[model samples]
Target: MNLSLDYAIEMDQKDPLKSYRDLFHIPKDKFGNDLIYFCGNSLGLQPKTTKSYIEQELKDWAELGVEGHIEAKNPWLPYHEFLTESMAKVVGAKPIEVVTMNTLTANLHFMMVSFYQPNKKRYKIVIESDAFPSDKYAVESQLRHHGYDDKEGLILWKPRKGEELLRYEDLEQIMQDQGNEIALIMIGGVNYYTGQYFDLKRITELGHKHGCKVGFDCAHGGGNVPLNLHNSGADFAIWCSYKYLNSGPGSLSGCFVHERYAYDKNLNRFTGWWSHNKETRFNMRHDFDVLPGAEGWQLSNPPILSLAAIRASLDIFNEAGMDALRDKSIKLTGYFEYLMNGLGDDVVRIITPSNPKERGCQLSIQVKNANKELHDKLTDSGVITDWREPDVIRCAPVPLYNTFQDVYLMVERLKGLL
Candidate 1:
């Protein structure tokens, strides 16, 4: 735990997941040196196997043409099915409860359609004040579409004055005061800005107790944290595969609908041929025999190439295991925090929770009087990190591909800049 380069090197040498770094194609500087990548929270580095995964599909298309749907190596006809169990495992859901389709916000809207059933009396929706912009936009749009004033129908679970993290007590108070008027509670499992991971089960229990449906946007939590979606008992959850999941940028997303709603065919949803019973999907004149569970949420066939990349990443996740990844994440992020604290609070202060259980790998650092110039300098110095507006710099040391040394060198470079 000492703040020394030697200590970081020793930790890397002993890291159980160290070999995973080589499995990913880390970006390089102009000199071809590996750039210290800490932006995995925004976009994950590509897996080495992703090339072959896509290549296999390309080859199949070249040989089989239109017949690739049935003749492809992965069989494009049911390509999304191939990723079911693995994707389900990644989010800790049953296969029947999970599916990979559409993009993140799109899937969020779909889930809202089914879960955010609001009446005039209970029409407001609850979200964290710092919810991701896309989620905010989607929820606002949903409120408007439902003939409710967005400003009036949207309830914000805000942090106390000058606080960076949201408190459960505040949420409990919100439920106590206005739970009757709240129809849905959609929270980000891991807040994108502050790197705070909320308790899904607790939130779900609280919402259900208030006679409101609950869901989560797990974009930041999905692969980075141990999200037991099934056990969390949330009505639904959605996540993109691009970040900690290590799929390509803007790749497909995964959806989780709790088992309780699996057989509820009467639940209103937007559907297409893909949601029909697979056996009867080709029957041109058949009635809509909706497929059971999460598959029923599908509106169209998935893009196989994207799913190929997802499959490659999920294969690695399955091999490394979430439990092992989470263990390394705690140690790795703890070390990052240790180094940041060693840098002295005069220069930089981490806004993320001190407790490892309350956050993921990302540490949002509030650099005193720092601006975009500092971030640009870090980039030019061969460190890749992301900058939020005002004063915060977000750095994520991904457990699958990042190392303790990466964290150390990054901090060292940051200290030098200071």
Candidate 2:
């Protein structure tokens, strides 16, 4: 496979999904050549069609003002409805169970209000040891707010000694040990830093067996991996649209409450005006009747411009189909792994799991004898990858826009720098 650029060129020529690269506007350096973008985990390259979607919403707002709520071709009152069907297919959820609403952290808080019930006896929350900071904070704060001590209420399911990736057995042990005290098991569906995809179904089953509520933070896994949330039996899940979903920064995020709770009025949620029943919403009566399905979780009218960007991205996903997208992703990322592994262990060690099923598009490489200096050098060379402090460098080969040539170019550049 070290057969030079011809191998990469040949792969690109044979890539059936090569046409998708044209759908996104790849970033360029000052010299006017395309920059090798491998940071899709941070932010996805913009879809070329995004402007048109935004323009439609802009025109409606300019012409109709408040009347646009009901006058626009796709009325603002029902704007979010346009997304449900497509979003459901992407995440393997029923339409009634999914809703695109607030930002990721906010949605996490809201989901916790409803699901993370901590009583006097069983009040612990279980999460991965190296969870995203925002997730850690959210769960910790939730614990404190309920008058529970964070140190005691939070149970971390950590990796084995000297191991980077967490195993399902470790989580099972934590649940078995703290089953009576644990109220919830909130995990990152695919670990952000390690790119380790946990077995969702297995975790959910174990949590349920212990009578603990289970949920997933799918921010990294959302569009990058197949999340059969419904079949996985997770009580809830949340994800941001800006990464693999390709929406703009701080775009609207998605929430999935299992169909079992879609109409369960007993589920205690923090409600607002938008959650009120539509028929009585305009009536503004004293009675607070809630809407059926996931729409009930929505607390306010969403920013249509942001949702417009998401719609544009989802259109691309719908055309490509997630299964087809995953197929391309596996091959493209596999090529990246093969090339990186060929670089030898003296300089590089892959922290992400070796099994394709255990990861999405990213590979976290631990650079030996390298600090931020090596990371800085890679950035200076125009290879756009992210660095998490201490040791690892993350590179994500997004199948939608990245080409095989980009991956080859990156490996070649890294080799030269070393």
Candidate 3:
């Protein structure tokens, strides 16, 4: 709760994960000083190891040609598998339930193909009113593809009048009223705008109680929050690596399918040679033998370069461990909140939840009468933040790289502008 610069420096000196900041290549300003990066919720800072990781793949390609598929230091044939266990540990799922493959939206569509089995009476999908634009569009396209009118088939779980956060009670009422008509519940694990982390287990149980399949878009929650996807009992989940996972921009995404579906070969899914059994995959004349579990959802062989970058980042996550990162994240974000609150509510309002368990590292701050110009000022002051439409400026003090000093300095700059 202390606002002094000495307090911030002391916290940084004592932080167990403080050394992690050195592992990333922090972006620099025009004068060559490191910028205060608080945009991890949009795109994470690249790890220093990412360059060498990609270079190794380039070396293999140059030296071995096609033989690199099986001859490289890390074989390209099973490259995605190298990421499974580490990714599962990050999201609190089993190895069989997780796979790294296509981009986030693509994986979401593929998941919907199998899980969104709409019948005559139950043919609707429920989503948050303020979901990320891509998620809303994907669900709408799914409804259209299934021969339903998008407007009629889409149900929005909206916050009450003038409210910024969603209420579980409102969701329960929606289920009580229209659950039977709802075929699936697809929600953001952590809301992008509000930064409200939903109760995954509670949502899954409620959806199940009403005979609906539940899934989550974990783009904002993946590495930033401890999802525990398996125990939540959600049928499926998808997330991008470019955000909190810290892979390069537009890198591969992670997908999760519950273990209960591991052996369900009968489930309908779009597949390709990559999803076939490895033994018979090269036997081009054989019938398709779909691999079990999340791997079965793969549509093609992944780009090895992207996998290499993901592996590099996952190695760091494996070393630091999500539990320790979460502990630091709670303290760091709490410090940021404490400092922001001292700025007075007249000038700033935080839309994100106050409870540490109900949000990740990101805090969505709405500045009174502010516009894009305010965001530009912060950027000029060497603070990298994201500005949403209207008035919110989102800042994430990532535990992997951001420090208490970074948080303290950001507030100081904001006060100057105000």
Candidate 4:
């Protein structure tokens, strides 16, 4: 809880994941000093190794041309495959259950194509009141596409009037009240605005009990926490690599379809050449043999350059290990919480949960009588943080790169701004 610079540096010095901070190219001010970056919840800093990983692909494409599909160091035809194992490992799912394909929203719609099978009797979809806007839009469109009134078909699981965090009991009550009518439950694994990490297994089991299929968008949770998606029993899930996964901006996304659905070819999905069986994918004469598992949802071959970037970042995750990273994250974010609380409730209030287990590295700070102008000031003062609507400032002290000293310095600047 000490706010002294020495205490923060001491904690950073003791951090097992400390060296990871050096792997990223921290943004710098004009004086060449690194900006205290707390924006990983939106976009992760680039890994130093990303350029080389991409260059290798460029080299192969240049030297081998069309032949690079089979002759290159990492073949383009199966470049996406190289990322499967590590990406699955990061999200805690089996290799068979995961695939790196389309971007986040696209993959979400593809998953809904199969999972959001709504009928007249059971057509309602459940989501958090403040689920990421894209998810809300996607589900609403799915409802309308299925010939249901979007507002009538949508059920929002909301927090109490005076609260920001959602309670499992409230969700359970929703299931109880609308269980039979609800066909699907889609939620953000970690709420973007609040940084609340809902218990995925609890939600999935509740949905299953109520005869509803469950899915999650783990864009904020993917590398920030151990999702254990397999154990969660969610029918499907999707996450982007640009944020906590550090794959670069607008990078490809990862999708997870539970093993039970792997061979269920009867499950309807959109298909393209890439989703055809690998053995006959290039045959061009064979019928559209939709591949099993999450791969079946893909519509095209992925951009190799994007996959290359993902491979570069996944390589780092493989080395650091998710468990160890999460371990540091808990401690790191705890330190952040402690320091922010030290800022005094009169000046700042944290909308994100105080319980470490309920959130990731991000803390949504609500400043009393302040606005986005405060965020701009922080940015001008050489600290990078995200400003949400109303009065919240989102700052994520990502464990893989952010340090204790960075947290201390950022908060010290915020105190001055206030």
What is the C-alpha lDDT profile of model 2 across 339-384, one tens digit per residue?
9999999989999998999999999999998898887888888899
* Candidate 2 vs 3: which has more TM-score: 3
RMSD of 4: 0.9
- CA lDDT, every model vs. true structure: 0.95, 0.91, 0.96, 0.92
Instruction: Return the top candidate by lDDT.
Output: 3
lDDT preference between candidates 3 and 4, better one: 3
RMSD of 1: 0.7
Count of clashes, each model: 0, 0, 0, 0
Candidate 2 — which residues are off by over 4 angstroms? 1-3
lDDT of 4 by residue, 71-103 (tens): 999998888889999999999999989999989
What would the per-residue lDDT of candidate 1 be over residues 1-418, giving only the tens digit for each residue?
Answer: 7998999999999999999999999899888999999999999999999999999999999999989999787799899989999888888999999999999999999999999888989999999998999999999999999999999999999999989999999999999999999999999999999999999999999999999999999999989998899999999999999999989999999999999988999999999999999998988799998999999999998998999999999999999999999999999999999989998888889999999999999999999987999999999999999999888999999999999999999999988998
Clashing pairs in 1: none
Question: What is the C-alpha lDDT profile of model 3 across 1-418, one tens digit per residue?
Answer: 5899999999999999999999999999988999999999999989999999999999999999999999999889999999999999999999999999999999999999999999999999999999999999999999999999999999999999999999999999999999999999999999999999999999999999999999999999999999999999999999999999999899999999999999999999999999999899998999999999999999899999999999999999999999999999999999999999999999999999999999999999999998999999999999999999889999999999999999999999999999
Positional deviation of residue 174's Cα in model 1 after best superposition, in angstroms: 0.6
Q: Output the TM-score of candidate 3.
A: 0.99
lDDT of 2 at 291: 81
TM-score of each: 0.99, 0.98, 0.99, 0.99
Error of 2 at 106 (Å): 0.5
Itemize residue pairs with steric clashes in candidate 4.
none
Pick by lDDT: 1 or 3, better one: 3
